[model samples]
Target: MSTAVDDDLWSAVGDPTRRRMIDRLLADGTGTATSLSEQIPVTRQAIAKHLAVLDRAGLVHGATAGRERRYRVDEAQLARAVAQLNAVGSAWDSRLDRIKRIAETIQRTGGGSTAEPDTEHRNEKE
Candidate 1:
């Protein structure tokens, strides 16, 4: 079962601003909300709000350092996101492989009718 954590992560990353903040943190290793705001067009308070969503999503975590809290990307959460994407890719690959095999069989037999004949490859090498 998928948890709310997944939803939050997806929602947080679904926005361009939040994604930019994440990218900034990744490129700079770690940064405060104010620092991220300076790199982007949003205000510091807006950046903080985006960071809050990221924090809830477990994509990022912040800690106190002197007078400000520093935010950093959580690699574990990123790994989970990558794994989910890879899973979808694997499923699509399997489906395409099945379609290819079926296509080859139909081409060889030449008697099948109306069975997804569109799988014929235009760019395939013989």
Candidate 2:
């Protein structure tokens, strides 16, 4: 079963803008919507919205820093995301290896086509 966090996590990071926001946050250690807007091309409101999504995904946490909130990336959640990506990559690699072996076996046996011949059509032609 999939959890809400998985969906939110992927949704948050799927957008280029949010990804850029994360990168900037990582580089700067912590940031506010106003500060991020200055570094990114978007408006402060947009940055805030992206930050909300990231916060929902558990990718970042925000603390009230006077008037504006200061956001920092959550290392543990980021590590979880990395591990999920690695697991998916390993599964694909295993599947590709299986496919390669099957192809090699077919080639060695000179079985160029897997489809069977149409006997009825061949009889009609003959």
Candidate 3:
């Protein structure tokens, strides 16, 4: 997916309420706004809005079911999201490993204390 689309997806999932809504839909296999609202603390209208955002992000699919629309997680899109998360996590892990190695090298070379002390605090005390 494009970066814009990826950003939208991430933004959609970034909200705690929306993430809980996704969890509810996944746990229940499917849910309507009314049904989800009953389980969640939000109103049905709020749930509908969150669902709309999820739909726009391609995280969930909705279909008309009688008077209300039913929503379910989109497995393929979810997998793609998971893949993106894993990629990001791996990149961070690599960066942290490099940072750890650098810190170890600095400690061994007695360069870890290269920074000056907090002279401002000493001046304030005086």
Candidate 4:
């Protein structure tokens, strides 16, 4: 909502493997490192490390289930991430629109040409 970027959260989701893990957990409703490793290319240990990063970013939460911790997506935090992305995207769109308007104005005023000689540079040389 504030367009504030969560660097830690973004960094956690930046990895393609971790995004795949998130997708897997979301699809299955829950997943363990072992289960995810079976579906993903990474080993169970690597999956566990990636899960730790997600946990630290508040993107996913883990609960002890027998020998392994079962993980699930944090819907609220995920929504927050989505809102941030939308806000940033809207900001960029507004900036681009403003730039386009300025360019159109310049073209209409016939100020977009570069045919004139550089009088300043000529004076400097003299």
TM-score of each: 0.68, 0.82, 0.85, 0.84
- By TM-score: ranked, best first: 3, 4, 2, 1
Which 10-residue span in candidate 1 carries the lowest summed lDDT?
A: 117-126
lDDT of 3: 0.91
Top candidate by lDDT:
4
Candidate 2 weakest lDDT stretch, 10 residues? 1-10
Q: Among these predicted structures, which one has the highest TM-score?
A: 3
Off by over 4 Å in 3: 1-5, 112-126
Q: RMSD per prediction, one decimal? A: 8.1, 5.7, 3.6, 4.3
Residues 6-115 of candidate 1: C-alpha lDDT, one tens digit per residue = 66667888899998988899999999988998899999999999999999989999999998899999988877776766676888899999999999998999857766
TM-score of candidate 4 versus the correct structure, residues matched by position: 0.84
| Deviating ranges (above 4 Å) for candidate 2 | 1-5, 114-126
- lDDT accuracy of residue 64 in candidate 4: 100
lDDT (tens digit, per residue) of candidate 4 on 1-126:
455899988899889999999899999999999999999999899999999999999999999999999999998888888888788899999999999999999999988768788999989999
lDDT of 3 at 86: 78
What is the C-alpha local distance difference test score of each model? 0.85, 0.89, 0.91, 0.93
Q: Which residue pairs of candidate 3 clash?
A: none
Write the number of the candidate with greater TM-score, choosing between 2 and 4: 4
* Better by TM-score, candidate 4 or 3: 3
lDDT of 3 at 54: 97
Between candidates 2 and 3, the one scoring higher on lDDT is 3
